[model samples]
Target: MRIELQNTFVELRGEQNPVASAVLDALRSNGATVGAVAPVPDILIVSLPLLPVAGYDPATQLQSAMATGEAMFARGSGRVLFLVSAAAGMPMRRHAEFSVAMAGVLATVRTMAMQLGPKVLVNALGVGAIGEKVVAGDAAMLGHASVKRPGTVAEVADTALFFCDPLNSYTTGQMLSVDGGWSAGYGRNF
Candidate 1:
């Protein structure tokens, strides 16, 4: 099966980033052809870059997401996996604008899922504070998470595989938070 990963950090960091490395590894392990062109790709992974939308105009933020989504949709068919930051749903003081913009992008994914339907299964994977180790500062922000720890690239990749799996049909218009239950509620281990 041919797969296309759009806006992947692999193009920039070339697996230097742990997440990119994990994603590539997962695809390769599944015995799927990566970066190959086909009439209709089996999977399309849309990784959202951390754009500097803070203090920027709202129109620009919307346009950036819309353009990216449109381009990805135009490229292939089958399944679509939108990878975004969990800040989209979190009340992050430092990343307020970014959170809002990402939320908008998530909404777009939902709309696309509805529009594309049984043809193209579009979904999203919201990543939380990912790090090699969970620092106190990082945990503080994500204290509400049941896991109470930063996520790992491997965890994110595993979830992506589930959503992008060709055999796994019937899942769409869903935003799965690989965020250790942070988006769920305050799970402070008091």
Candidate 2:
């Protein structure tokens, strides 16, 4: 099966990006043939890395995300897993653009799930931090998480792979927060 990954530059560029490595490893383990989103039956994996610290553009990012979603929905089989940051729902300092853009992505996932359901299973896996390397250029909110530490790449990849599983026939339009309780509430120790 072909897997079309939207954002893979960080994964491809960083030696310290364990999430990327784990994603690739998971795909390999599952024997998935990964490729671009052409007019082919491929599993679409949308990964949103840390947005650029400077020059963040919400409109452009949103459009790109929508276009990609439309393309995948039109061309590939009805399966999309958004492996993104918790920023989609939880905002952080100086990350307004990222937050907005991710919200758009989540909206697309939900709308597509509703429109294409029974035929497509669209879901999101929200991650906080994979490693310092992964969030080097972006503002990280893992300190507020109950775990108070970066999540392992394996944790995230496994979730992504689960959503991509061919037998996952019943889920759609859901956001799975895999952020170590970051989205649960404020982490406090008394």
Candidate 3:
């Protein structure tokens, strides 16, 4: 079940993101071309911030992602993969904004899949504590997760490859959680 994106054209939207870099590398390795956004790219990869940024706005970000998807779907056949955080499911009283954004990303993925089906495939990869504890939620959630460690950025990139694979014909409107079993039992200790 290896990912094969040969000759696929990918348009990546992320600002100095290492995960995006990793994804691009993997895609290029698999014979994909990373370039500017075309009218309709073979694959549209949006790398949403895994941790809360200084001025992150959930509504605005989600709106932009949807707009991007709509524009990319103009030609009918394409794949949209949003790289978001799985920790969004683990609500921390201190990070309402981020939680909302993450939840919105998931919902948007589903809704878009429904609206743009039969040709365009929409999916997401929910990232989880990929590095040192950056926020209060990460520390709290990791305690309950069976895998008491953070995931690697490469893991997220690999999942992106999976979602972008043209062979994955049956799966759409789904978020494959790469958070190391955290979602399976995230709030167990809480």
Predictions in order: lDDT: 0.61, 0.61, 0.73
* Collision pairs in model 1: none
Which regions in candidate 3 have their CA more than 4 angstroms from the true location?
Answer: 132-139, 186-190
**TM-score preference between candidates 2 and 3, better one:** 3
TM-score of each: 0.72, 0.73, 0.85
Residue 181 error, candidate 3, Å: 1.5
Worst 10 residues of 2 by lDDT: 7-16
Model 1 scores what on Cα lDDT? 0.61
Looking at model 1, residue 104 earns an lDDT score of 77
lDDT of 2 by residue, 3-106 (tens): 43333211112122456567667876666655543443345565566433344444554454455556556654456666666767666556766777667768
Which candidate's TM-score is highest? 3
Could you give me the TM-score of model 1 versus the true structure? Answer: 0.72
- Encode model 1's per-residue lDDT on 128-163: one tens digit a residue: 767756411134556777787777778888887787
Query: Could you give candidate 3's per-residue lDDT for residues 142-180 as a string of tens digits?
Result: 665578887777777788778877777888998888777
- Model 2 TM-score is 0.73
Rank the candidate models, highest lDDT first: 3, 1, 2
Per-residue lDDT for 33 in model 3?
Answer: 84
